[model samples]
Every structure is written in structure tokens, then in C-alpha cells.
Target: MLYDYPEYYETAFSFRNIEEESRFLTKCINRFSKIDVKNVFEIACGNAPHAGLLQEMGYSYHGLDINRNMLDYAAYLWKDLPNKVNLHEASMVDFKYPIKQDFAYVMLGSLYLNDFDEIVSHFNSMSNLLNSGGLYFLDWCIQFGDPLAHNNNNRFVIEKDGIEVESEFNIKLLDQEQQMYEEVWTIKINDRGRRKQFNMVERNKAILPDQFLRFIKERDDFEFIGWWKDWNLDNPIEDENNVTRPIALIRKR
Candidate 1:
């Protein structure tokens, strides 16, 4: 099940800098495309913090996710926004929108589909939804070696208002042949001394930059722009081992 614990999902990654992230995305759209980016689409927008900020910036935001729980949470998060914000419960591989978008993005490792066919299908669907010369951006973490062996486990404790959240993350390589891994997140929440705990296990594939570039080149609907090591557009991806999350920017042909 995807995003089984929406509460834990909200708590685990609660500290992300939404303003900076949205600004980065906006900068990318401004620099790469000639169209005025008023409508934006996001694939697997969990909680949609970025979309909420983007909507506040006067863009119409549309977010799609297969998890209804996540979409409901995203709706609640964006309830106070003034601009148009729409949340849809749909899979990225086969979703069809009524209108074409000027820009689209898939943040985090949400672009990791089940297999090569699913990846291709997602790209095709996304390309079909974008106008000519539009932009599509995606980012994901690349695992070079065993994450557990490298002591990559994380523990986060966040306290806000009257609630306290403690989250522990454990990652393990599940299959070597398929280049797959699983991340188990255990979250403990204390709200006014009332304690609750839950666990969410996420399975993802480690797709290298070369593999993604190859896929983009194979498709005629998109043209490869460039890639960044992390979030900084100035820093190109030189060594995959040095960077945890790499971002790819492409344009629809």
C-alpha cells in the first residue's frame, strides 16, 4: 500500500523548507521555458507543500497522487490558499488531465516506478499533458551502496504547537538484481501527552543518472536539458557517489 500512514508521512518530512524549494522550482521554470508558467502539475504530490506555496505565488496548481489519504491531507493543507489548487487521486503512469500544463514536476523519489515499462509510461503520460516546449522536472535520491552499511539511518524529533513527533528511518537493500530497496519509517507522536505510533514501509528503485538520461534520449517527445547534483542548478552532477539526490530537467519537444 502506498502512503498507508499519511500522518506519519506528514510528520517524518515536516521540516522541509517549502519556500526555498518552491523558489528553486520557479527559477527553473523561468530560466528554461519561454511560456508564462501559470499552470503547474505535480506527480505524487504528497501533502503538496510545494503546490500550496506555488498556488500562493499566483499559479494554478494541480497535484496527482494514487493515495487518497495523501490527497485529502493535501486538500486540507491548501484550504486557505487563494489561488486555484486541485488535488486528484490518480496514478502517474496513466493519468490524463483535461488541460495541458506549462510546467510539471515530480519531487523526491516519487518518479521511481515499478519497472522500466512503468517509467516509460509515466514519461509518455506527462509529455502528453504538457504544451509544446514546456518543461518537466524530477528529482530522486540515488543509492550507490548499501544505505544501512553507510550508517544512513535517520532519527528526527520535531515539536510544534502542543504536539511532538519522533521519527526513526531505517533503510535496507531488498534486491540487488533489480536495484531495489525498502525504507521503514517508525513514527511516534505525542499530542498533549497522548501517545500514538505507526510504521510505513516504502519501496523504491535506485535509478542512476545514466539510466534516466538513456530513457530520455530514447523518447522523441522530450529533449534533455541538464541535471544538477543536488538542488543547486550551478552544480552539475559530476560524481553520483558524492550526491544523495540528483535533479533532472527536461523539455517537452
Candidate 2:
């Protein structure tokens, strides 16, 4: 959708916007008993549009993102709210808060990266932050087939105030031995006949559904609770790659 647009993302979240973000967070909050949810933490919180949403639900939640610019924007937006939402600019790989949380969330495919070993290491690290039987909600992209075997490319263009921003997604085959795949993204921001483009990409060492299940099984502290292939709250069943993305619900045992 308009999520790729830097301008739109600078102000608010994409698609569901603030209202839908509120509803989603509220649903997550309700999952636990009312006595257990005084503090909430969200990793890779982006602009923290969801912070305002959490505040409305009576949670004094904290948001963390790696980017300083996005954190500044979040602080500015939530300055007037009655309940203060904390924002931290730090990498999820090494973030440690003073207080342990009853539940944590890392939205979208933010945790997936090029390194399979590192991904598991990162997941293992989160276990220490969780309370007994604490929940960790994660969402990730699922590769149905061999990701390196297929090439998919798409382009998204957005125009705002005479400025045209174009994001081109180009898939490059890396290593098929481990189903490794990389997509290079080039974003061109043009205005008044002048243009500047930013090139960024994610190289994911792909893991299929079965592989993910096996990996989770090896973890001693977390138990697989539920998996939703699509974001739909009602129907949780769908094939890989065909689904929007998967939301993984885990509990510490």
C-alpha cells in the first residue's frame, strides 16, 4: 500500500492507520488477564503510531526502533497525550530494558534477515526478557517454494506535493543451496526535475513452514501457541507465500 512512501510513513502507519492500529493492539492487550498488563513493549516500533493506540487502551507501553529520525517523529506526535509513551532508538539485537514485560510484540517481518543462525540467536535472546508464561507475538514472511528458484520484481510509485518517489523491487538469486534469496530495493525521490535515489535491500536466508516449526521446537523456553498465515482474525489457515504474512504467537513455559 502506501507503506513504502517515506512521507506517509513519517506521519502515520499504512493501510489500517491509527484507528485500526488501536483495535489491533487492544485485541492483543485483552488476551491477558487485566491484572497482568501494566507494562507492554513493542520491538521495532517504527514511528510508534501504535503507542497512541496503546495509550487509549490504558497501557503505559514502550516503543523501540533502530532509527533516530523515526523516534523523534514519534516523540513529537505523542507529546500532548496525557499518558507518556516511551520511545527507544536501539537495535533489537541488543536492547535491554530495566523492567521485564508480561508480553512483547515484534510486528511485520522485522525479525527476518539474511543470516539463519543469527536469526535463531536473536530469538533465543528474547527469552530472558519474558516473564514466566509471557507471550511474544511475531510476524514474518513465508516462502512457499524455493525463494532462490523464482524471481519476482515489482515497482511502487508515490507522488506528493510535486515530489515523485519510486521504489523498485528487484529480486536477485543468491544461493539456492540453503534457499537463500535477496531482493534489492532502489527508491528514487524526484522533485522539480531533480532526483535522488536510495538503494536498500534485504537478503533473507529463506525458511519454509516445516523448517520454522522444527526450529521453534528446539527452543526450550518458548512454546508455540498459534500461527496465523493471514492477518485475518477469523480464519487462520492459508498456504505459504499466498498468505499476507504469518503471525506467530509464542508463550514462555
Tell me each candidate's TM-score: 0.89, 0.81
What lDDT score is found at residue 174 in candidate 2? 80
- After superposition, which runs of candidate 2 have C-alpha atoms over 4 Å from their true positions? 1-13, 16-18, 29-35, 141-153, 159-164, 190-194, 238-241
Q: In order, what lDDT does every prediction score?
A: 0.78, 0.67
TM-score of 2: 0.81
Relative to the unseen true structure, what is the C-alpha lDDT of residue 28 in candidate 1, on a scale of 0 to 100?
Answer: 93
Report the alpha-carbon TM-score of model 1 versus the true structure.
0.89
Give the clash total for candidate 1: 0
* Per-residue lDDT of 124 in model 1: 81
Candidate 1 C-alpha lDDT tens digits along 104-126: 99877676576667777888899
